[model samples]
Target: MTLALLPRYDEPRLLTAQMELIDQSFGIAMLGCSLAAMILASGLAITGGHPGALPWAATMVVACAIAHFGRLAVPDRLTEARSGRYARAMTAMLVLIGSLWGLVAWLYLDIRSPAVVICVLSLIAGMSAAALAVFSACLPVAVGFFVPAIVPVWIVFLATGDIAYLPMFLGTPLYLVVLMIFARNYARVARHAIALRFENLELISQLRDQTARAGQAQRQAEEANRAKSVFLASASHDLRQPLHALGLFVVSLSRTTLDAHQRQLLTHIEASSGAAREMLNTLLDFSKLEAGVVTPRPRPFRLQPLLHKLENEFAPQANARGLVYRTRDTTATLFGDPSLVELILRNLIANAIRYTRAGGVLVACRPRRFHVSVEVWDTGIGIPTAQHRDIFREFHQLGNPERDQRKGLGLGLAIVEGLARTMQTRVTLASTPDRGSVFRLRLPLAWTAPEEAADPQIAMRLDGLRVLVIDDDAAIREAMAGLLAIWNCPCRTAENEDEALALLDDFPPDLILADYRLRGHRTGHEAIAAIRSRVGRRLPAIIITGDTAADRLRNAHADGTALLHKPVVPGELHAAISTLMRESEWSRAEQ
Candidate 1:
């Protein structure tokens, strides 16, 4: 680094470094001179004479220190005017010290002794050398000292006009030139060093500032994400109530007689309602995944059946999109959570169908030593290798920048990743751009075991089933009444826990379907608890909630009752009811 490369703000700093060198030089030069004077005085005293160099050395020390000490007394944070004045003062003091040293040449000028001549010459040479060493950090200071010290000695040699002395005069100017060059180079080196130090310090400061700002930005982004999640959870719960009621009403409408045109209109309305419900469900799934609520219940399951189920679900969707769907079935039984495995497969196969436009989608199985790798391969728009990690992030989609909801909400892969982690496994991907993509899920293969007789479960008939519905929302209570009316089940609707318990006096409910939250913050579990106490039986109950809270869902699962999120599909509600009924029947039969 050069002085020019340094900012103008550091001019004072450069000046201060040069001045520090001068400070050290002052003490050293004075010490050297005092020692020389003592030696000279002792030599002359032995010869019965007095030394003249002593007084001259004393005077020079005083003169030089005047300006140097004045600079020290000045205030810190030197301004431009003050620094300039100090430089001029130092240069003048340097000249005074040089002239005094030069005058030594005249002290022994006319002496005939050869020893005196040699001593004078040696002393002047030492002074010139000292000047060069001490003040070279600033060339002007060096020049001021050396020029006055050496010129008088050069004149002494020339005045003698001896043939032998000619070289001294001729060589003096060359000596001075060499010293100037060395001093200038030394000054540049000093300035460059100071500049480099300041630059490094500035860079370190900037790096710290940038690091702090980046940390703050990351914190802010995380806060925003958390706030957005809270808002969505609140909104999801509020919206689900009406949609749940609408879904029930729609289910009842389906049981009525209708012509072709009316049926088509009804189907479109159902599709629109289904789309809204699907998005909400996706959000609910993501919430549960984040809340660590999904616990995989592992068991021995047939891999081929899960594959067959996936094929049935996505094959029609693929066919509708003008693409082929195929599954290379494997008879190998796998041991894992059957439902969670099915959910993961559904996400992967759905993604395969959504992205593939031309060729087809394939589900295949490869047997490893300990794990069976179920792969979903597709001739879809392939993901780049760089984006393989990002594709699993929530709301991060590939080739869908416009965020087409029909393609998906971008939570499918994120849910898959979360579920896979909860199951203590991982998902891997291999893809080529525009060629195809393959997503593989590795699961533990079940070892061969003696087959136990399976207990068959038959669907429970809903005819004449006594059901009780408890909800604070009137529309929900009315919807429940209408739905059960179509089912031809004798049903009673209650507004509170008291009403539900009161209904059990005469018309006891065989099944209780209760909203999760009622008036005064009462839960479905509370109302169902009252009903069971009144009936003196652990009657089957299903808790239907619009809450996207995973903690509540997990807690609800602990009591071993059926749970369903709202905007519930007709088929899901019906299945849950039938399963709970069959379980109640089995429990009674065992007792």
Candidate 2:
């Protein structure tokens, strides 16, 4: 397609320059041809015994040759003087000169003499041909071909004999065939050149596209790393305030005599501690999602219990926000990673509750032929049609101009969308501005007969779990250990492999948690390796780090390890610990 068009070579300025270069060569050939013709004509004119004819013939030849030489001398000036509209005019002039010379030689000199006239015609034709082949300047290719062929025919036909017309007519078809062959060769070469040019252009375009994509990916990676750092610092600062308060409250309660009200206030302080922990966890999870560190493993899961849990968790929050939060169950098992689906619904509900000033939010699940559609319908500050996709992008908060004051990091929906994509599920949004919005989750329903059904009500419980935590931050290690202790799991802290190795002498951990970056000559991976080597068993370890570097994340994945980010919340930590422990137990049973 790109080769479909060719550049203009016949433009005036370039053609002019080319013509100028070969003008002198053309002039010499023209002079020789004219001189030869004059000689031939002088002989012919004298055979009829004319006294003035020889001089006249010599004068014509000398005058025309002088004109040709003068034209050659000032070729540059001529080209510039008539640059724009010169091609047609110059072509016409050349034609006129040749015709005039032919008429003069034919009529006055030797009109009826075939032999003498033929000799003159040959001179003229030879000159034209020499000019075309040698010069190739004054005219275009078509003119070059036409001039040599046209001149001889014109002279021969003007001889006024039947035999004279024969040479002219016979040469006509041969000239045409020669022109066709030249044209074909020219087109083939031009076509090949065009095709090669187009291929090069296409390759360059593809290279540019690839370079742009790589640059974009690098920028995204840097931004995600920066955001992760910000999340870590903010989570640490925010969580520390409440954690410090809880520590003080506990210490004070233990030391002093406290009234019932004071003790009750301490309990409230503890609840605030729990909330702060959850917020920290949410921040860490959101950071991981933004860093593209979460990989989904889809499995068949019960839809009803998951939905029920979300409803129970959000009912009070929705009520506090004066919004009706309800669920209509499909009462069928759905096939997906239930944890991811739960997270999606959680964020959807949280977003709904945060934005809705009044009216209601509904969590409805409906069964299709082979799949179930889960919808989160909310009467809230629904996104404008144009802003619908924008809301699903990271750090994009619409409607609320002062987004930093909102309840979220503006990453909840982004995580939901990312997770949905990983699970190969479509998340479609339908909304009316300032009225309502509906987010739908379409998933295949896993078939379970009535006979196979057990007690549908399920509870998530984790007890008697041992988790090993290795981090450089003493505060985070102590804090995580305290949180895990509260969740009824025993946790041991380590700064690096040496510390972890020291701990493993007395107690081998059921599961391992290590940081991506560890102090001198060690990493979380090395710690896990050391522990595995000592115990002579594969330990399910999760790398917990504040580093949101893509290379680190990739390394963790390549090594077949799980990960968690720093400033982790109590609930998510509990979940991660529980999951790893359960997986370990499953492995043990299989063994």
* Local accuracy of candidate 1 as per-residue lDDT tens digits, 1-591: 676632231265677667666666666675675566456545544552446656765676566556556566877524444655565577787787778767766564444567666666676677677777887776777778888877887788778888876787798777877877887787888778767877988899988888888889899998887777777777888999999999988888888999999899889989989989988998898988877778888877788877888888888889999999999979888888888888888889989888999999999999999989989999999999899999999999988889888888899999999989999999999999999999999999988642543775565568899999998889888888888887778999998998888877789788999988888878899888877887788889999988876567677878777889999887787788888888787888999
Candidate 2 at residue 356, lDDT?
Answer: 89
Q: What is the lDDT of candidate 2?
A: 0.67
Runs in model 2 with CA error above 4 Å?
Answer: 1-108, 111-300, 405-407, 449-469, 478-493, 502-513, 535-542, 557-563, 571-591
Model 1 stretches with alpha carbons more than 4 Å out: 1-13, 20-52, 64-69, 75-85, 105-133, 231-235, 255-261, 381-390, 396-402, 421-424, 430-435, 448-456, 459-474, 477-563, 574-591
Q: Who wins the TM-score comparison? A: 1
- The top-ranked prediction according to lDDT is 1
lDDT values, one for every candidate = 0.80, 0.67
lDDT of candidate 2 over 63-111, digit per residue (tens): 5566566554544543645644444444444555555455554454454
